[model samples]
Target chain A: MFAAQAFASLFSSPAKTSSPSLASDHPTGGQAAHHAKPLFFTTPHHLKLTYFPIRGLAEDIRLILEESGIAYESENISFHDWHEGGIKQQRAADNPFGQMPILYVNKGEFILSQSKAIIRFIARSTGLDGGDAYSAARCDQLAEGIADLRRQYATLAYDKEFAAKVGDFINKTLVNSFTTIERVYDQNKTRYLLSQDRVSYADIMLFELVDQILALGQDARSVVAKFDRIGEVYKSIAARPRIAAYLASSRRVVAINGASASVGAFKA
Target chain B: MSGDGKYHVHYFAGRGLGEIARIALSEAGVEFEDHRFESLPADLKATTKFGQVPLLVTPAGDRINQSTAILRFIGATHGLSGKTALENAEIDQVIEGVNDIRAKYRALPADAANEERIKFFSTVLPQWLGYFEAILKKTGSGFYVGSNVTIADLYVYVSFDSVINKTADAQPIDAFPLVKAHLEAIAARPRIAAWIAKRPVSQW
Candidate 1:
């Protein structure tokens, strides 16, 4: 654990250090030597992240890029613009799933799509994947659960009877959805999902989801507070200087989703 | 670890999320116990951290949920994943691409005559399939990632197989020649074909 923490710090605040061989950095190397090659991204790599004109699936990604001080621009595409011969449509044939939130890496050398893929890529490129393959696998597992939670939130938000059904969803369904997260936190006894002092992809993703839930005001806040460890993760992540600044900056995405009739935090 | 030890994979009898991991283990020629259930028993469910299926009880006795996580573990140790973070991301994007279509395809009302389903089979499904077809063309490697077969290929093959017949035309695969051929190619691999033939029969 000590070595893992030290490995994490080397990448968390990346320096222009010489590359370390995979075998030297990872004592448990060979099998995962390929997967564990950490890219020390002292400079921005994800040049542009394009998504719908809402937080939707891109907020966690935005959080990572900002916290790492990686320079990138966000391009928001409206539904109309996507269908109106815009850049999104132009890139559709190449875009994975022909969807928004595609990343333009290093000035479009590689155009990567899919939110989860982008999140992991940014986490890896910026050293947030928990330092080794095992911890990285655990981080991936927790992040998958958060993706499921986000999907549930989206499903309810887009429900035809959202106005009538949202109260029940916020009060009951979401609380149940969070049980595994709370359990993971309890079992780890860490301030963050994977580490006590370091932030991982899961922490960023959970923070993004919690931010939306908290934005729903007192009731939502109280429900989240019910999971004390989750609250700690949220506070610790939001307190990071860059993350804090990003949240306070004009670029903070206020909408939890795209144009849904009654999405809790969709600003419109 | 190089996945030298045995493992136990738990899931429903049906070939859903669990099938991918099963296919991966079989492909890697790793020995493991395959536990299937009609539904997760309460006792078994209690042991799962999330009360979910497709849990892989590891060689180390760790209970891992999330099909992706299990696949990642297998992939990393079994030479079925990419060589670098970038390569893995590229591989993962393909799976996420399949997932994106699967979610939308699942949400369509089940009525065979529904107009939305009609539009989906004719437009949406084809649209998504074309993206994959183009991916194959771009890679031109006969595999989703790298020169060798990865979990990305298996994932796309399994996911598309389950949903491609939803409305016949609604989930069309014929027009995308590369995707259609890719599916057939994957289905015909000796080990994969043996597993497919011997695996349990399920509607889904």
Candidate 2:
């Protein structure tokens, strides 16, 4: 009954009716409609990210922001507001898909709504994407591979029967997936995923994937430990001055996943 | 290296994840083998980077896994990629939007009697369609990303084509005028139309 009421309140919020259309001239008013004003892809915008308090998809972008040393702002949408009050309390419904982790350029001058898209945007702007055409393609290859691994990990994290399935996931799924990933990691034979001198966005992605899996407790940790290259790459990324500082800072997200996860739902 | 100078796309027979990569090749006027596997054998699975299909084998015998990765590689090699960094991001946002909805659809049990599944078709699917429709209107170029047909347009077209074909909706895009026009415009393209006609029929 309470859940229903809260949901009702969320839909009935005053901001719900006001579409984030482009004509508003409100400068910061995010025009969310596909029927929005004409937006040309010519310039860059100031960066701000809005997402739930969880680190589900936003972590990689956050890692990029930290490593890039670019000044940015982050807004967290609490579960309470999303259910009882509507997310518009933080900002208007500017997201295309109404999903979080939306990157607002110049406070809604433009809103990029996908995590992978946002990651590539920031990574490119910050020079963390890659150096040349060939290296850039390799970065994409690594990121996509990490994404597949993340999918398997996400299923385990969100499974209602998490306890029942986690062991099998660790033994079979984790092992098999890593076998292929590690092989790719071994291909470059370098200190970083991309080059000996530069760490690309794919390295950050790999680091976070390893970190999240490590949070699944000792057995899961043991499974991931076998991937020496992934571990080596993870350590190198963590040791970066900005990244190291960020890890110990208050801005770092403590929660590894959502509260529904069977494990590592640590809250800041 | 095979030294055959032909790309080989390995995936299940249907146009699922592999369709975008296949579409990229088709759009670029590249001839490649559409290697289908009804059941992926363990030996082949072991060789892939993520133990997943929709892997692309370049003419050089480099095995690339993940559907999007293969698509990106093809987009880069060919002219299917965005004209600029910002344009590239625009293309990716559209592709990811399609992927996001597909993930939601995949989570649903395929029972017409299922309440959630019914809600998905009735509510969730329309909401997503409106989102895409809005994007089409905003771009105003009759394309998703920029002024040209890119991998973004290909991804959007195949995703909706598969979905509506499954539902057998006579007028799936009726409520979405721009999306409707975009679908027709994409379908009428010579290569895409030819591929659609020649492709194998399967129960998606």
Best by DockQ: 1
Runs of candidate 2 exceeding 4 Å displacement: A1-45, A88-93, A266-268, B37-46, B59-61, B169-172
Interface RMSD, per-candidate values to 1 decimal: 7.4, 14.6
True contacts kept of each: 0.47, 0.41
Largest lDDT belongs to which candidate? 1
Best-fitting candidate, measured by TM-score? 1
* lDDT, candidate 2, B83-165, per-residue tens: 55556677888888898888887888877788888888878888899989877876779998767787889888888887765
Worst 10 residues of 1 chain A by lDDT: A12-21
Task: List model 1 lDDT by residue over B19-61, tens digit each.
Answer: 9888887777766798998878898777677778888876766
TM for every model, in the order presented, reads 0.88, 0.84
> What lDDT does model 2 reach?
0.74
Per-residue alpha-carbon lDDT of model 1 for A61-107, expressed as tens digits? 89998887887888877767787857665886547566768887656
